[model samples]
Target: MKTINRFFVVLAIALLLSNTSTIAQEQTRPEFVTITTMHWNMDNKDFKMEDWKAVEKEFLDKITMKNEYIAASSFYLHRMTPDNTEVVYVQSYPSWEAIGEAAKRNAELAKTAWPDENARKAFFKKRDAYYSPMHSDEIYATMPNAKTMTAKPTKDMICYVRKGHFAYGEGADEEFDATSKEYFDNVTNKNEFVKAYYPMAHAWGSDRTEFLEAFFFDSMADLESMFDRDTELFEAHWKDEASRKSMGEKGAKYFDNRHGDYIYTYVAGLAK
Candidate 1:
């Protein structure tokens, strides 16, 4: 996104102070994740969903799956309430060095997969034809409170992403971490409709105040139910109206009113 509005989303990240904390953090997430927002070539009449999947899967099976530096990668197709032409591809790395290492390793893997000079060029040309030349990338630092997927998704899953910005910094990092963790444990963890969740903060991006969160669901029906489930969970956890109101007031201090909601289809075959 050239404009700041066309940017990336949610979470309180924990900055580790010691090796012990770093070990525990790795169990939940990688040190960094890069989300690339790219557009589909609308004028490409020859494009087919099946063909695109086949091409991406070939790259996944040949390079990404075999790449040790990359922890995970996936693609999300736009579903609603945003530019329909957009497709987001995200890749996570264990460390900052791994990000550069993955690129070097991928190059090596590509050469091995297509050794012939002409064949290599031909393969990439076909792959590159699927997307427009313009694209944008943002790198995020993963936070502590994440709901991990138990298993790989077997089909296209409904995914919702929310991006918001931190409006204030009056509270200490400890306070934000405690408050966010409490809510994540109570409401987010108990919400059955939320199949998976990943919360992150802006790392190397245009806007430093940006926060991003990704939620996964089995279907659109389940996605609809997530909000209702969250309300039920929240009420049950808070119990009294006073406590619920206090919780809201606490969170509202850090977040601005502005936010963007995006729905997408999480493609399964192309995941790595």
Candidate 2:
């Protein structure tokens, strides 16, 4: 957890050395993101999805929603993974220092939310029962040029994730950054089918090669439409075949020729 939190500090220093100008231009995006992979306790025969959601909502309202240091918090349930028991919790911070500050804030809020000691204990016990002990965590650094949402969603959305591996021998940092920002501005942001998109690279995880792109859609139909719309946007944005090929080849140089696709349902009520 400490290593994961420290990623933003390391990321900030690297970015400053390579591209300090960007930091001054865009300060709204999350600096760091922590992803926790956990499993539902299948052994508990009394489990109900609503009950779990309710418990989580209680905690979110009490702690996460009130935390000044936590920029954003969300929960994602496995939709198309190999296993059904997986649940993911994602939290983003404004700065690396905010990670430690948020923990301290949560403790203070928890006490205020449940003033009675016994009630606090009972609430936590109930919450803990819903999840298994086994869990893993990874931290990622948000890349430039994301397709941000125009408004907050009121319902659960389907999230399609494309995970790629970085090749690391790409040319100058300026070339990759310029190309990525240009592609996102011209093509990605124009896709009507895609509600929101986030591109992240590994920061403090086991696999440094990891690069994950999450695209959100209103439904399964919209997700399929996004692919068709992607081709249309790409062609329309880059008319000539040579221009398209050049853009593709330049982007391809940054990543290995391998990626994995995963799907999840983003719970609106559990979001902060």
Candidate 3:
């Protein structure tokens, strides 16, 4: 009887230990913050196309090489039509706070690396010539319960770009809250393809009254299929075509331009 009781006690303790270990593993899993910089190509007349490579190389060799804040980084040149854009700089951070700290650290490093104020100014002036005249950024917080795709992204890992337009003269804060809740409580919960979704706003730069919703997937093929599924879901939820069209029209009035998109892959060690 004594041996039997001892066996049961040991079993209970082992089970408790297993459960505790599982919880700790979940808590320690790394989270990532994606920072995307959108920029335009310098006019062909003013800046030679070949110069892009030099600018990119300098950034990788000079800026990123010395920066410790960046976990991983990737640069992309857009391949899509008329948008003949130049570059997309994607960097990952371990947490949101790290994002701010990383920027500060980079600035400090830049100053140290270029002690001459005039030389530093010239460096940025020359560096700025690679892309479009204007640019914007969208910051995303990763989700915990989404499915990541298996196929490698030709550019960045599979990412879903959710573009939103705000009515002219309207503040995005309220609309963002409503739409974000709709996406999380309604869309993502109902759709299994949604591995994770992140919401970002135009904090600085860019003229569009836009918000970006980023979704991650395992592969490009999976990303294509998700749209078909999303279309079906949209039809089912918003059954009236007229109503849907009217809502789209309303969203259109807020923007002078269409939202932009790029599908890029994560650069390992660049993502936190």
Against the reference, the lDDT scores of all candidates come to 0.78, 0.77, 0.50
Provide the TM-score for each candidate, comma-separated.
0.90, 0.90, 0.47
Q: Residue 74, candidate 1: how far off, in angstroms? A: 0.6
**After superposition, candidate 1 runs with Cα above 4 Å error:** 1-28
Total backbone clashes of candidate 3, pairs 3 or more residues apart or in separate chains: 18
| Residues 114-211 of candidate 2: C-alpha lDDT, one tens digit per residue | 99999999999999999999999999887666778788889999998777676677567777666666556666678788898887777798998787
Ten contiguous residues with the weakest lDDT in model 1: 1-10
* TM-score of model number 2: 0.90
Best by lDDT: 1
Write the residue-wise lDDT of candidate 1 on 85-166 in tens digits.
9989999998889999999999999999999979989989999999999999999888766789989988889989888777
